[model samples]
Target: MSQSRILVTGGSGRLGQMVLDQLLHAGVSGIITTTRTPDKLGAYASLGVDLRHADLNDPQTLSKAFQGADRLLLISTDDLFSGRRVQQHTNAIDAAKRAGVRHIHYTSMPEPEASTAIPFSSDHVATEATIRESDLSYTILRVAWYAENPVELGLIPAALRTGTWLTSAGAGRIAYVTRSDVARAAAAALVRDKETSQIYDITGPHAMSAAELAAALSRSVDRPIEVRQVDDTALARELVASGVSPQLAPMLVTTDANTRAGNFERVSHAVQELTGVPPTSFESFLVKNKARLLGATDK
Candidate 1:
């Protein structure tokens, strides 16, 4: 449904920035973005996008920022170490409800229950429950693993540097979709007139296993990546040994475990259905990011 305004939480992050771009490109009007650091969104403001200072961490600030918004896009929080991811999401959902948002769109994962390995996944499950419990119109975009995860999570760089790709996800395939494709899907859902309660599994066109990922990266970066399959514990230790924070290591470990269990094996056409654009392939993402991936390894 068309609305007077739409609000996006966590607007300063990478995915949020891309979602804002998609919304602007779609000619979406009355866009409001919330971030703890509003000054960081000056560029968005320059483009006539409404910017507001609202920290999901601080529920008090959200009331004002969430007000005047007819629709809302609740981006899941990434505050893994804080032990407050669920509470933060709850705060945003409550604020949106009180602000009288008619419809809500959320960026979730492919299977909420399948994220048992991922400790932070509770936040997504909890937020979805809260949104549904509120009896508001909602669309949950179950965004699959990002195609850029290897680079985003430092796996690509580390692999390139060490010539080894370590994983616990043996023969498990993940339908990794690009962040931009997920953003486009979110933007499309935000502006659509549908008020139905629904969920869309936003995934890439194809699924690939860890070994296949290594091969793709090898070709893209023109380097040999030796795939080493290890248990979850060993994977965690390796990540920590490679400079990953001790706290973040566990979450990474569980992500692989979840994949190994086939939790992320679902490949859906929801991205194209929602955005009217084909989801970018993981191979294409690697090719496009070849330069940046190599540069990160050098660092």
Candidate 2:
């Protein structure tokens, strides 16, 4: 039998919703999900999910939400761009420890210290360390690139439309895992009894570069799209001009450099091994989201 009760925090988030759905699909009956705004979680409510009101920033609220839960899915807080996000994560971890949760499942970045040089990566890296050091059984699900990342929908499509894909990730490949795949892996880990201190680098099968992705989009949309390698200085300028934080400009540049350096270059079999199904491939991802992505190509 699964845990008596499985509690998922941030259940309303994109990945969180998928995790919740997969857990229900897996026949886990006693599922408890927490959201800051319970009223907004109408769909989950209709599914007979016990909704608890709790903000990740407040340990008292988290403790109440986590009580009586044998398993806890600590969906990483979405306030990465905010200044207080790290503190918010600390508060949630503290509450999990206080509640004596049996297993703490964390949704973390894949090589947060190395990927895309985003500021959030540092936060995830620190959180992973905190989870490891804490006196609790933990499963670290280090997620690789999410195929549905905004870059896929926004910048990539925009670049395709203009017939110009500009980035410093020249020929660098990444195993872009889907949100569903990551969710499935996390849900699978939650239901299983594994030794503590287990770390799984969840990734997809294929590793494609920006140029290759551009080619895929071109084929999908029936257009000629070209990938242009922009220098770090130009990349920083473009990001800043696009209203991206000046503070984060350097981070993006660093990330592009890391990509070129082949940081996110590995494909992991963890997903297939854990879920008994291969993780979604980048081509499959492009096919499914072809509408959303190609929709932008029309404009």
Per-candidate TM equals 0.94, 0.90
* Candidate 1, 241-265: lDDT as tens digits: 7756676567667778889989988
RMSD of each candidate relative to the true structure: 1.8, 2.6
User: What is the clash count for each candidate, in the order shown?
Assistant: 2, 1
Give a tens-digit lDDT track for model 2, residues 23-112. 889888878899998888888878888899999777778888888888888888868677777787778778877887777888887677
For residue 158, model 1's alpha carbon misses the true position, in angstroms, by 1.9
lDDT of each: 0.85, 0.78
How many times do residue backbones clash in model 1? 2
Query: Which pairs of residues have clashing backbones in candidate 2?
Result: 116-255
**How much RMSD separates candidate 1 from the native structure?**
1.8
List the candidate 2 regions with Cα displacement exceeding 4 Å: 150-153, 236-255
TM-score of predicted structure 1: 0.94
